[model samples]
Target: MTDFYDRAAAREAEILSDALAAQQRRARNGLGAVSALACEDCGASIPEARRQAIHGVQRCVGCQTVQERLAR
Candidate 1:
């Protein structure tokens, strides 16, 4: 007999993988306007370390998290 549970687990894994790939793409290409160490929204200090770490990050971590939450 076929195992329904196994099928469900496979589907869940596929969905999770796709979501992760999409997130990676966003992280790679989302913040294109962040050429300086300042928040485009609040003018808060965006550290040099952060910019280097996140490719093209603009807003600080707090602002970025809030925006991502709202997006979901």
Candidate 2:
């Protein structure tokens, strides 16, 4: 009986963690989508292919790459 309860608790925690991670991802994507289609840092136009590939892409490839590198 104790083992079963522990397993159930572990499963519940796992589910909750997954749900929170997904919610965070959605929020980040939503914020990105709200940004202007043109690159925020540079005036370059965001390509259609990139917009289609990423649900909410705010920057052009070059700007995004630079930002990502700086972030690291």
Candidate 3:
């Protein structure tokens, strides 16, 4: 019973450690980065709200819709 508890604690610690590392990496990736001002496909300006909401958005809604359709 003690061994099982120990193993569970160890696993929990490892999972928490991995979660922290992933969060740190994601924060690093986002640091000093801004979303695109214009859509790559249509050369239209992206809205400020959308740009702030998305990390590295490169397309407007219309162009993204078209691209997604093409992808499918």
Best by lDDT: 3
lDDT of each: 0.81, 0.83, 0.90
Candidate 1 vs candidate 2, lDDT winner? 2
Query: Which regions of candidate 3 are displaced past 4 Å?
Result: 1-33
Models ranked on lDDT: 3, 2, 1
Q: How accurate is candidate 1 locally (lDDT)?
A: 0.81
lDDT by residue (tens digit), candidate 1, 7-69: 999999999999999998887685564555888778899988888777667688888888899
- For model 1, the superposed segments whose C-alpha errors exceed 4 Å read 30-35
Q: What's model 1's lDDT at 26?
A: 86
Model 2 RMSD in Å is 4.8
Pick the winner on TM-score between candidates 1 and 2.
1
Error of 1 at 66 (Å): 2.7
Candidate 3, residues 1-72, lDDT tens digits: the string is 579889999999999999999999987787567788999998999999988876778899999999999999
Q: Which candidate do you rate higher for lDDT, 1 or 3?
A: 3
| Backbone clash pairs in model 1 (N, Cα, C under 3 Å; residues 3+ apart or in different chains), count | 0
Per-prediction TM-score to the true structure, in the order listed:
0.69, 0.54, 0.53
